[model samples]
Target chain A: MKPSDHDNEHLLHHFSDMDQQRESAKLGMWIFLITELLLFGGLFGFYTFYRAWNPDIFHNAHAALDVRAGTANTIVLILSSVTIALAVRSLQLDRRRRAGKFLLATVALAAVFMVIKYFEYSHKIHLGQLPGKYYHYTGIEGTNPHIFFSVYFTLTGLHGLHVLAGMGFIAWLAIRTFRNHFSAAYFTPVEMAGLYWHLVDMIWIYLFPLLYLVG
Target chain B: MAHATAHKKPHVLPLKVYLRVGAALLVLTLVTVAVSFVHLGPYNLVVAMLIASLKATLVALFFMHLLYDSKLYFLVFASALGTIALFIVLTLFDTLRRGDIYEEVSRPITPDAVIYSDTARFDTAHGQALPEEGLMPLDTAGIVSPPLDTGEIGEQVDTSDIGRIRTGPGEGGR
Candidate 1:
């Protein structure tokens, strides 16, 4: 198809037009998110297996987690998701300045999430509630107290990496938005990044309750 | 070349949609955290998971645009979720119901099974050679081979030193 006025420079030749291109990109991103879900699903399975085996131990070990910090991080991530979604919406409306601000807010919230995560991890390290053979905390009564920490570190550690990646995505979108690279005609990147950010938040939504508030 | 198909303009949802979804998500987050504190026994997990699922659905439908986008995206995502459910459920089936039938016999023998127990001996002299008394019946009762004299070999190899992770079959090289 020949390039037309409706088609922006962002639209690739492989697609019929901007709509097709945007939908294709979003589809691809969703597929990638599926794989990401499966990856975390495996860990979730491992967690379930161990949690079932050591119910009492899991119950006790989870108590060591700071509910306040976890709750704070949860709110931070949810708010970040909101900001990224708003950023996409703003871009769709051709409000470039507002979109940039929303993107910046998302990045700032992501940093706040990481800072809280840093304190949580350092506190665990201090208490010697380390995973595997390095576990030295004797406060919890369990045959293998390290098992809970092992699952804890693996789940949250992986999720933290995703948070950092999401931050990078939003920051890049922010820079691009400020440069006027995205507008109402083509904001696929912003939308795709929003999807990625929301997925990260979704994973944490599951993680927070499982890790911090096991009943 | 001119194409016959005219692509419809991409659907842009209203800001109100986002704000409402965002508010719902925040409220649900608070609800999940609050529910966690109520001590619902086993139901606590069920409630937590249900609330989390609801929040995830809202994000997927509104924030991620699945509600406004093509059904293909929703199908692809739901399939992934179904697969994950299978993954977790099948794993739990194996682990949670293990040893339900045969009890102790069906369960996996621990690494410290008597055959690899502290008192069990590794006859390095035999090293893949058939026993002089011919093949013995399989026994997990810890008596796989007779104990050999350590002094004759000039070095005592303590199998127990391998601890919980006793390597099998290829230890003859040591």
Candidate 2:
């Protein structure tokens, strides 16, 4: 057997073997991802119920959101998800330099998404179109308009926090790749990071239409 | 071959497949924007959500590597999503089933429409002043006499009455 394979065979006390350890770690990550889904799911449920209750108000209020900007961000996030997936693939092939480059691309795309979001949020704040009671703008005369912005801000704000966290993870992973910390033998970190980054993109996929395109 | 199998790497889709998925996602986004302008009435929302769902599925299956992962991971994700969907549906059922949520909100603000559950204060729809809904809310000038001392005084003013119409500048509920 190869020296590395011999080293891997000495399993930790908690794990019966290398296969068990790897499978358990993966299953743990999946469980955590679902829990994260549930957390966001609650807020999403809130938006769904309110949207159904006041469909017209949602329609009128969402007009203030810039579709162009939202569309751009959606594309940016999709690109980032793709790059991160590529990064994981590169690491699995033991291409450290390629993996690092893809990680950089993913981080760059996430930065672009946040920058666009900053402009969108600043515009809303400037107009005093704040969530709940702070909504002061009168551009549209509709019932319970504030509720729409309330849901909008709440959903986007939470999703944005996830994006920020994902960016931090990608940056760390990239730096680690530069140090040759991952190889085909053990590259679970890159794969896990890729999973998380895709989730961020998946959320924005839903948000883009709900907030900007449709009522 | 046996050595390579023991040291196996996780499955990775080709670069071409990833690029193709990215292209499809971008195209679908554009389609969403285009569909919004067509004015499909209620269907507009349905179509948009469907497209968004398609994009999300692609990202999850390809980019997230769920397609190549174990069935156990699939089960976890599916159950979470199913539960979330149930929560939304049940909450919406409760909310949509309620009575007068919209009527209560819109009755006061509609300038042209008259209000009055039991009787019309005036034929506001005609030349008469708009009714205050089922209850005629009167201003001080309109009030024939001061309300008599009542146990309910200094308590929550019934907004349905005109005496408290436009309660205060900060009172956004009205």
Candidate number achieving the greatest lDDT relative to the actual structure:
1
**Can you give the DockQ of every candidate in the order shown?**
0.35, 0.34
lDDT of 1 by residue, B106-171 (tens): 112223333334444355543222222223322333223332332122122222221112123322
* Whole-model lDDT per candidate: 0.76, 0.74
List iRMS (one decimal) for every candidate: 5.5, 5.2
Worst lDDT window (10 residues) for model 1 chain B? B154-163
TM-score of each: 0.80, 0.79
For model 2, how does the per-residue alpha-carbon lDDT over A1-215 read when each residue is reduced to its tens digit? 43445576344577655556667878888888888899889988777876775777888988899989998999899889888888887876778899999999999999999999999999999998887557778897666477788788999999999999999989999999989888766777888888888887888888888889886
How well is each residue in A165-184 modelled by candidate 1, as lDDT tens digits? 88887898899999999877
Tell me the spans in candidate 1 whose CA falls farther than 4 Å from its real position.
A1-7, B1-10, B101-174
Which ten contiguous residues of candidate 2 chain B have the minimum total lDDT? B107-116
Which candidate wins on TM-score? 1
Q: Report the C-alpha lDDT of model 2 over B1-174, residue by residue, as the tens digit.
A: 122366445375678999999999999989999999898998998999999899988887888777877778889999999999998888777666543331223222222223212244443222233324433345433332222334223122232322122232233222
Q: What TM-score does chain A of each model score against the native chain A?
A: 0.96, 0.94
RMSD of 1: 8.3
The local lDDT score (0 to 100) that residue A44 gets in candidate 1 is 90
Which residue pairs come into collision in candidate 1?
Answer: B114-B142, B115-B142
